[model samples]
Target: MPANHRYSARTAFLLLACTVLASCGGMGGSSINPVNWVTPYKIDVIQGNFVSKEQVEQLKAGMTRDQVKATLGTPLMASLFHADRWDYVFTLKRQGVEPQSYKYTVFFKNDQLERFEGDAMPSETEFIAKLGKRRKLGDVPVLEATEAQLKAAEKPKSATASAAVPASVPAGAPPASYPPLESAKQ
Candidate 1:
């Protein structure tokens, strides 16, 4: 074959192969590209009671175990073997965000809170903010009906006004005042 003709045939084959590969990129199924769609939904797992800083700060060295329970709610782990120790653990696992775990221990000596230890606690507002709460930008609208409007709405409407009988109503039965049915003479 002539050199020029051979080069042309090779170019045509290469062009066809390039077009086929380019079409694959637009396919809906898994493409040759490395990119993947991010998951739209992820469950937020919360295993234990969330303890705030204020609740922890309320604890005093002499407070009774019952008071501690009331202030911090029930402990996540209260073992039978360790009667004096109460452990409160909080864990949150959210998608695309780092998991968080907090541990607090309370020791009771004669049913009184002897001491408590844990990491630095977050306040109610701080914790809420950290959980990705959107702050209100402006005053919220208060929607309420006036007395007259409420009374009008509360008034019973006539059956004829609806003009549509419910399907539950039986087809039988004419009024007692209606004339009695009699057979006509043939």
Candidate 2:
């Protein structure tokens, strides 16, 4: 190629690259950028022990470590350095709602719980309400069959068929006798 032609080609390539880079840099902080309008889906993140108010209420001044564990579940953090202290930490991160975190610490003396303190835990029902999404529910349809529907479903049985079957067992009634689960050996 001619020297002038080669120089023009290099300049054109550099200009194109600069234009592309400049456009991208402008989008970095622009509100009109696609990234600003459309966000990738983020899953809820829940971690560590979740102790409810009811469980905390069960704790007493001299409860054993085993009892405390049974009532409030295992602690999230228990270090050898803090052998007598049990720490329960819970965190929840949801997309639209604000993040939630709670920490509770239990101090023990002579292998028994001496005292406990931390953030006030929500009740089970309150926590469940917080987790549910806000939406309007439609009216529920009636599920039970009417008397006319039940009568229409019933069919008259022939006398011979009725005789063949001794009697109809009532609904939910246990069988007169249950056959042995295993076959008898000859």
Candidate 3:
């Protein structure tokens, strides 16, 4: 036989052997495709957020557990030992981002927030109430001053520093609005 024919025959035999081995190994039923798995999949996890101190401060220490529940919705991880202790635990993990988003824990002692162990606790609640949704990075105010702002602010303090003007009151702004109102007829 020609050398080329022998080479072709060997290739054919190798392919046939592979096909037989594949069938025995359940290749037809298997869904593991190497080409499909080659590319790395980007896993994105958008975790929900929490409330802030101001929003939760309205919740008093003596307030019933129900009231707290009503105000803050529900705790994420309740104590298995006692129902009274409520733990609002938040844990987030991103692949290449910061090691973590700050863990916010609101521990309620006898249904009232006992100790604010984390800075993230207060902001989460207030953020939710203010935005009518959980807080995101955009919701959280950024304090990192831009280069221009830093330069402007860094300028020597003017002897006549600009007065810290109060916010502008809009038209029809009330002097002091309260719940109780005197009848105009009276």
Number of the predicted model whose TM-score against the real structure is largest: 2
The candidate that wins on lDDT is 2
Ranking by TM-score: 2, 1, 3
lDDT of 3 by residue, 1-186 (tens): 999999999999999988877665665445574434455755646454454565456665566667767776676666787655665554454444443343444455656555434444545555346334332555667879999998988868554543442347554577665765866675
Predict model 2's lDDT versus the native: 0.90
Which regions of candidate 2 fall more than 4 Å away from where they truly are?
Answer: 1-34, 134-186
Candidate 2 per-residue lDDT, tens place, 82-111, comes to 999999999999888899999999999999
What TM-score does each of the candidates earn? 0.57, 0.58, 0.36
Candidate no. 3 TM-score: 0.36
CA lDDT scores, all candidates in order: 0.84, 0.90, 0.58
Ranked by lDDT, top first = 2, 1, 3
lDDT of 3: 0.58
Model 1: per-residue lDDT, tens digit, 71-94?
999999999999999999999988
What's the residue-level lDDT of 25 in candidate 2?
69
